[model samples]
Target: MGERISNSRVVISGMGVVAPNGIGLSDFEKALRNGISGIEFIPRLAALNFGCQVGGIPPITQEHIDACFSPLQLRNFNSDGIIYGMIAAHEAWRNAGLEPEAESLDPDTGVIFGTGTSGIEKLNESIKLVDAQKVRRLGSNVVIQTMASGVSAFIAGHIAAGNQVSTNSSACTTGTEALLMGYRHIKAGYAKRMLVGATCEHGPYLWGGFDAMRVTNYRHNDKPEQASRPLSETAGGLVPGAGAGAFVLESLEAALERGAPIIAEVLGGQINSGGQRGGGTLTAPNPEAVKSCIKDSLVMSGIEGAQIDLINGHLTATVKDPDEVAAWAAALGRDKSNFPYLQATKSLVGHCLSGSGAVELVATTLQLQRGFVHPSINSEDLHPQIAKWVPREKIPQQAIDVQLDRAIKASFGFGDVNACVVLRRYNS
Candidate 1:
């Protein structure tokens, strides 16, 4: 992992997003550029007496569902994560111009989809049914639907993948880690293309714990759009979100051979956990681990930190936002003036838990390809600690045109785990 493999550059050939802000690359890009707010008040949360009554959920319609699934596949499908993952995976496959229903399994292709808590809603329902002595009513697909590998399994079956289809869960770091793992497979010459992404099940069963833990914003229940204020001095807490993001990644050689549109090159990345040491816990990140993750990511990517044109932070609009900024400042060895443009995509889309990294990765790739930085909405008032570490002007509140030659996306999860990825524009 120290040296880059010759001719092993991984590039993003296609992307699909089922996010709170939008679905599909085109719509998601539009939402990002326009600074759209996807967080909304959920009456159910309010009715349930939740501390935070607002959240970000993708607005998937019946038509959208019909477009993604067949009549047979739709039957007995109780997993929201699976539904989201399928739509996103299919979108990425089609966007990459690859036919989903191949004649046979492409032995050199596979999937590495991830999820945080798989099908908790379905499991919750099943538990109640069994408690009521109605276990026989549970469908045959319940096991598959509620399993941790369900999303990846479904994607693999639908795409006819043959090489190493697997699911990975690392709290919130699942998505970025999955992408990097898929890239490693392609880089190692074990695969030609890897479908990589993550999804989180939508609903109270999945979100109630965070709400009970008082980690979500309750003040903005009356104003959902402004509730998730990442990097802002007035930021309260994270606004829980659910969705999926997918990408088709292949080696530059393979993408070129297939005449695929190169979106962004995956330079390299790092994945590690804090072991719950040095102020780290199940609920907070260790500053040292966060810093090391970034430093080693740069080393693996073979790029200087100064070369980072943009960063989509893991800032989740909580008290920890300042600590994240501080870690970034320390990791890059860049003071205020020399720092790169930093913004919180969570400011607009909220935190998608396990799906955040992949969704934000798609946004990061879009910025690289489109040569623009999406606005960091609801961060007009930067936290004093962050402003001390970064220049105010470096944070863009409106879409700005810039050559994003190199960018880094990082996700720090609940278990004090961290993952980072470096991406660069496809020059060739």
Candidate 2:
């Protein structure tokens, strides 16, 4: 908390995203700008009798596969997580002007990609084959595709990452936590560039648990676009989603040396857990820990609560949304109109589960870089508690230009864990 602003600053040089609303950076940005909803009704989920049949899933094309994977790699490829991860990671790498081919592994470069549950779809496939006594027919790629570290391993090998190439899984916080972790790596001079992101698989097997738990929105099955209603009074439940988002985090000095476009500067961040105590449960966050996490993040960033201009929150369109806003207000020591402009990207993208933080962070970075705040659709009739803490106009249903010089992004996941990062416009 002392002289943190003078510490080694980390900056995002390149970004790539595979979202249900959009496929690439350009498409994603456009979708965000225009308030496009990616949540749709899946016929399979309905056929499977899932209570929540609508969800957000990216429309991946074969050309995208050909660009990211080789013919041999795709022969037995059954993991959609791998497909989304590679596409997003490769885009981030190339966006930073790095080529995929490397004559030798670079110790200064590595990856910290993450996923919550890997290859659930592939695991289901393997289970069926084994149950039918056709285990021999199971493809050799099954193991690699379903493993937790599969996404990181594939990208590390492709990029020739000689430094620490690894994976992290933290439920919904996987992505944002990875971003903070990678930033720490660069700050500690462990690596010059770390490609960090998170991907989540979709379909019946992955989302069935939530459906069974009755934590997903089933009321909007017919009106998919309106299903995910973060910060709204009528939010039934979260609409599960799947996608990937990635960024190339480079040391500020290294980015300047290489003339990489700095999208935003990571001032500092913090990751902590509430220990599932004091009203916190296996599925809910402890309010005390949530406040501390945000305060600590601000201290680490050497900034005051009042300096923050925007917030990209982990509002999953559940009963937790109001509680989350209360935590932010309490942590920042701000009330009502004094609070910074708040937004919920999940209103359009739905809750991406483990990938939610990363995709939302991408949206946050783009919002700052583009000098406009994307609309938080489906937020009409802000929940009474939330409205009491913030102005209604702050949560617009349409995009607007604003001087978003400083921002904070936070993600809270199951296990009562929280990760908060401070980002600001990289003004040289």
Candidate 3:
């Protein structure tokens, strides 16, 4: 951990998202405001006799694909993660008023897109071909599609970025970490702009492992929309989801000079791990580390815990939800009477794994910019333990209007990794 640079400020100028509930910014904002649930029944899961048949998948159409990919580039392109990443990245680049067809490379622009499993579907295809002694039948794009950094490489070319281009994977923390990495790159005077985000593929190949572990919700297959019940007592487990989210992060000065649309300010953030010690494990977070991560983030942002008006939490619908709430209460030194407005994006889009942090950050940014907190749907039956720390009204079931200034978004991944970022409403 290092001190935040004193001279530089980072801001999010533009954002793009491909979420289970919605495809673009306008639709996504409406979905969040309306408490729309993107979790639905996937027939393939049922056919495979999996314990959880419901999942969240973006409703992407052929037109959406055509808009992002040229016909030649789509040849044998079976990586859904790459497709979602490219769409979100392209939209973000254009949304930031950056030229995609520029003749010269952008020496000051970089990319840090990430994914947990880049192309399981393509890998599975290639495996079968090799096993059948038909290796020659494999397509030319196999390596690029299967590699972890494929998304970043694709975006680098699409935007003609000549600066640093790389991928990062930290279980579910990948997206939030990507944003912070970009922020640090600019703060250190390495780049003028960075396109950062993460994506996850939707399919049984990637979700089957969770189902086999019995960590996915199997009780709500009949009630797909209610499957992801974050903060609810009736919650069983997470409903797996997939999609991508992206942001164009620029220095405050550069954004102002270009007259770009500033969505929010990236004040500062903290990223750390529990080292799977002190009761932390491959699947659970260490309480102390979680608190320290939140506290350190506030310290870096130069704000007290009470200054945060909202908390976009990584409250996946599971037994750990109450623990996360308790950690926040301890870290902020706030009780039920004055805890900040808390909402769970997973309640609307399910647990998107590596993509969860980025997608939720987009939701958080929208709430801060628009002055409203979206409801934590399906949490009507709040858990008893969580109820002790947060008032019922504070966990809103419907969108509420409020003038928000400072908000925090935190993500805790499977490997006991945690990331917290403070964001403020942009003010001239």
Candidate 4:
């Protein structure tokens, strides 16, 4: 179409999820529609333990993970990053109907991953071994595996991506940021395609940091699944969750040339910052900044706000963030009556930090493909101040009668850095 030529568009050909709800995209969608929760309690952390539970993917045994890594490049992998990345990458590749080797696809395709806090548990364990006993007890590879970009680098090498490949450590916005970078690379003619997204494990140190912020919900010790009620009147705080979400992004031209089935187009994306020490706290998001980013995304995508039928929100059940987003929606003249049908994925998978946006993107892609918008469960009521802008009830599970032509996924991180991506249905 004429519109396709004016824009250098990229499409999401495949997606993968390794979250508490399930290990693959199919299982993830099923669980999301059913409103399943994967949160549970953990007794062991530091003394700051609130006994409040979290959404955690049960630990994968080393042997089980190693089987996927294989012998050739196993030594190069940092356990924390590469193990989950390989699993997700394989799932995505298979989901897209691509061979593990990338056959007809260009060797110059890139790879990018987002990671917030990497290998915190392994670092803590290494420190303990060094302090109590001896350095020999601590593994030699501990340092490499604990670094934030180790996983991204390991995946790039594993996949043999011949062009530019990198990682994003942009806190909560990392996954969206990674996707943006991939989209840009393909759009700018830098590469034909890229693998993008993020993965993280539930580590004690991350929870400890949250505890110090006095923001984590310590009151819900008995009910883990019901704890992360974003936008709910009873919602207390956003809990830390661990998981990986990834997507394969390719240029439309490249995909059709290779006979790849396109899922949805990556219409456009934008990122913005909220500036320095926001009133002494670094994590608060600014409403104006969030609005600006959304505006930019809309402009770049060449789409009207009315065309956005769904919004995958970054509805962290935090005190200030959700209200900020609500204010932005309100300022845009979107309220209960005219708001985009919204769903917060964290209510099901928990907040995966850097991995949250990508995981939610996979959910949205499935939504568009199947024409069904999943509900934001455990959030039956909204905070009085922001209730007018949020969808507080269960969304119907039936497939939408019309085509899902467009949607948006919003992600905001500490320091008010935000990223929004516009996704559109592809007409093959």
Local distance difference test, each candidate? 0.90, 0.91, 0.92, 0.74
Q: Tens digit of lDDT per residue, candidate 3, span 309-385?
A: 99999998888999999999999889988999999999999999999999999999999999899999999999999
Clash-forming residue pairs, model 1: none
Q: Candidate 1 on 313-415: residue-level lDDT in tens? A: 9999989999999988888888887999998888878889999998899999999999999988888998999999888888888888888899999999988
lDDT (10s digit) by residue, model 2, range 1-428: 11222246799999989999999999999999999999999999999999999999998899988988889989877898888899999899888878886788788888999998888878988999999999999977888998999999999987888888899999998999999999998898778889999999898888999999999999999999999999999999999998999999988887898889899999998999999998888899999999999999999999999999998998888898999999999998888868888999999899889889999999999998888888888888789999999998888789998868999999999999999999999988
lDDT of 4 by residue, 156-212 (tens): 755667777677888888889899988987787777778899887776666667767
TM-scores for candidates 1 onward, in order: 0.97, 0.97, 0.98, 0.89
By lDDT rank, best first, the candidates go 3, 2, 1, 4
Clashing pairs in 2: none
- Residue pairs in collision within model 4: none
User: Which residue ranges in model 3 land beyond 4 Å of their true spot?
Assistant: 1-6
Error of 1 at 95 (Å): 0.9
Q: What is the lDDT of candidate 1?
A: 0.90
Q: Which stretches of candidate 4 lie over 4 Å from their true place?
A: 1-7, 45-48, 58-67, 71-81, 101-106, 136-140, 277-281, 328-332, 390-403
